[model samples]
Target: MTESKADQPDEKARPRRRQARGERRIQQLLDAAASVFCRAGYTSASTNAIAREAGVSPGTLYQFFPNKEAIAVELGERLNRRMLETHGVVFTLENAALPLRELIDAVLDPMIEFNCANPAFLTLLQSSDAPGHFLEEHAALHDSIQDRIGELIGVRNPDLSPERRTHTANMAFALFKAGLGLILGHEGAEREAYVAELKTALYGYLAPVLGTEGVPAQP
Candidate 1:
């Protein structure tokens, strides 16, 4: 028998609904995997543990991801993409034109926030046991910071040669990463202190090369 027009719409909608639910399930599993990886480390985490963390059965988890490695790789990719998005948002021309202190705040705050919220990302990044391809992907992501920062710096300090700009960007990221580790290691007042100290360090470090704190960049 031919279906009615109204019934056809419902039938077509059914597939979309199923696809949406499937996407949600995939997200759920990935979130669970991230949490497990964060708490247990990549080497110690198992598929069953991730299923438990996700509040799903092992079979349900397996329906989406065949093994723990697949889950870790997918989670790493998602986290990397999110970090790149945050990077893009924070490194705008407006941000680059801010005064030195504000520039440091604008650039570093989101980075620290991203790392804090997604502790699992740090775990995956530091993990030697993660999938090889994922590690290569992450390494490429680290390289993006230099390119982005070099561009931002060049906009402010066009007089500097390309080599100097690259070196400065690398040095800036290194300092920020060092401070980030310290900031993440503390709490409350201590964390705030570390953040203040980081800004101070960056201000001093970049002042000569970039300019004074109160003065905004020309471009």
Candidate 2:
């Protein structure tokens, strides 16, 4: 006797369940990879180590990511996307009017928090052993951010020529990057102090260009 359709196993439902399980497994693998990368550095981190950390067989890890570089690439892409979103939120019309310190805090605080939470991002980007593609991706992300910064500078100082605005934005980005290093390298009170110093430096440099009245409210 043939079984009713409802009595038979639901093939489509099985696939959907499997896919959900697979996605969860992939996320678990990525999390383990992040921990390994942070501890061992990208060059020294092994797929086997990642698998072991993830409580999965090395074969399982290979099925999802063929190699360590692939894992790093995926993780880097995830981080880059998050940073892009943060930049979008911070560089909006609503934020354009904020004082330089508040504006810088809006941009820098979230970034520092993200980096602190994902140390592997810095490890992969900074490590010489990481894939060249990671560096290229990071460069593109940096360019996008700097371009937005230049636009914001223009908004704040409408009288400044485009060339001057671009120059100031580049300089501000340089200082911000340096501050990031300090923030990541220190902990506790030192990190807080570094952040304060960074804000002071940025405000001092930008205030003159932005004028005493600070960033314009509407632009």
Task: Point to the candidate with the largest lDDT.
Answer: 1
TM-score of each: 0.91, 0.91
In model 2, the Cα lDDT at residue 194 comes to 92
Candidate 2: where is the Cα deviation over 4 Å? 1-10, 212-216
* Candidate 1 Cα outliers beyond 4 Å, as residue runs: 1-4, 7-9, 213-219
- Model 2, 75-129: lDDT tens digits are 8888888888888888876666777677778877887788888888888888997
Error of 2 at 147 (Å): 0.3
Provide the lowest-lDDT 10-residue window in model 1: 210-219
Q: How high is the CA lDDT of each candidate model?
A: 0.88, 0.86
